[model samples]
Target: MLIDTYGRVATDLRVSLTDRCNLRCTYCMPEEGLSWLAKPDLLTDEEIVRLVRVAVTALGVTEVRFTGGEPLLRPGLVGIVQECAALEPRPQLSLTTNGIGLGRTAAALKEAGLDRVNVSLDTLRPEVFKTLTRRDRHQDVLAGLAAAHEAGLTPVKVNSVLMPGHNADEAPDLLAWAVAHDYELRFIEQMPLDAQHGWKREGMITAGDILASLRTRFTLTEEAGERGSAPAERWLVDGGPHRVGVIGSVTRPFCAACDRTRLTADGQIRTCLFASEETDLRAALRSGAPDEELARIWRQAMWGKKAGSGLDDPSFLQPQRPMSAIGG
Candidate 1:
């Protein structure tokens, strides 16, 4: 295991396949997105598989997740999943997508060894969806969710970002919809990862506000279980087995238990989502660095990992790269 100085073992690795996205979401970035990484600069499919192999074989990584500006936008996604699944003591594989392109590829992805998926859908209303995503593809997302579920991606999780004065009143509707469709729902407090650097903590929704709304519609009891390094705090809804998760990064920091790291599409390794800087793995990869050396570099990066991103610290500042570029 790659244990940080803080004693947190990194068992999960998030690899960004690409930074290109099909949608221009209001919450994700400004109407006009930033310049993307050149295709020649991004990691090839073979290079990505080799990196995953090292993490699973040389390190104690047990789970591998694919993230992107939108993961499905990557052409070799299925092949990536297949390569990861072929490893000895294979790591569990999952993906987080915006779901615009998922309907066409979910079954193929599942057939290739994907274990689960988390789709980002903020609102169910078509008008709200268009306003939020700057795209008229809410129905496409809905289709993709159904396709993922039908492909046996059990408990397909829906990741929604709660923004004040926007889609906040849809909590009850979102919950009821999740209950009816059997998809686990998680409402995340908006974080300061936007490409525009426009996130204001005061305007962002908090965990307390989310629970209060849930209480009005259904009962919520905090789950009495270990949180480990997982970001979401699980809770049982209305005394049923159905679970609802809340991620309060701004109000309730979980950096102390964050046993995860990220690799950018361009091959930079980031120990934290809000890290001020990243380690350039692409330089090593292009310089004929072996798996052992690559592993060593990863370890060295984590060795300096901080306890967490101190959002409340007076010196706190957003990363130069937006969330899309950072592979969150």
Candidate 2:
């Protein structure tokens, strides 16, 4: 097990299939975008499966989520999912995407063993979407969501990041939409993960702000239960049956129960989202290191994980790699 001194064992793995994204959301990167990782630098399909195999077979990861600048953009995604699904103790597979190409790929992905999807959609208005994303693909996202539902991706999740001036007021409407469509909605407080490093605590929306906005339209009762390692704080919308989630990653940090380990597209292990250090597994994998050696390096890296993401500390510095590179 990848157990830290804090006694937290990692059972969830986030794998970044690529660092390249189709949409340049204002909060994620510049309009021109950041430098893309070279093809050779990225892990091949076999390499990715091998690392995942090690994590599941050796390190005890049970849930595998594929994220990226936009995972749907990966040409070999379906094949990769198929391979990962074939592991001995097959891990639950999911994808986090911007939902650009999902309309065309959702069914294929579901067939390839992808259990479900969490799409990033901030607003229902096309104009606001364009303004925030600097792209005119709002309808594409909605279509993708519908397609995902049609493909039987049960409990399709929508991840919304509330930026203060941009669509922060849409909380209630977003929730209403989710309830109507039966999509589980989660509102995440914007973190200091932007490429430009322009995030300010005062300017970013908080979980409190989201609840305040939501309470105006709906009665939310805190769901009874320990959140375990889940990042979202769930609330029963209105009376029962449906719920909304708030991930206050900054203000209500859940690092104490964090069970996630991240693997970059290039095969670097990131013990934390805000980690300043990354352990390289690619070099060793390419240099003929045995699977046991690879697992040992991974265990050592997780053992050294910081107690928490120091977002609340005065000395906290934004990670050098932005959210795009870090795999959200």
Which candidate leads in TM-score? 2
RMSD of each: 0.9, 0.8
lDDT of 2: 0.94
Model 2: per-residue lDDT, tens digit, 1-328?
Answer: 9999999999999999998988989888989848999999999989999999999999999999999989988889999999999998999999999988989999998998999999999999899999999999999999999999999877799999877777988999999999999999999988899899988887788999999999999999999988899999999998879999999999999999999999999999999999999999999999999999999999999999999999999889999999899897
What Cα-based lDDT does every candidate model obtain?
A: 0.89, 0.94
For lDDT, the strongest prediction is 2
Candidate 1 on 237-298: residue-level lDDT in tens?
88879999999898888998887988999999999998997999889988999999999998
Q: Model 2 segments beyond 4 Å from truth?
A: none
Which residue ranges in model 1 land beyond 4 Å of their true spot? Answer: none
lDDT of 1: 0.89
On a 0 to 1 TM-score scale, where does candidate 1 land against the true structure? Answer: 0.98
Reference-based TM-score of each model: 0.98, 0.99
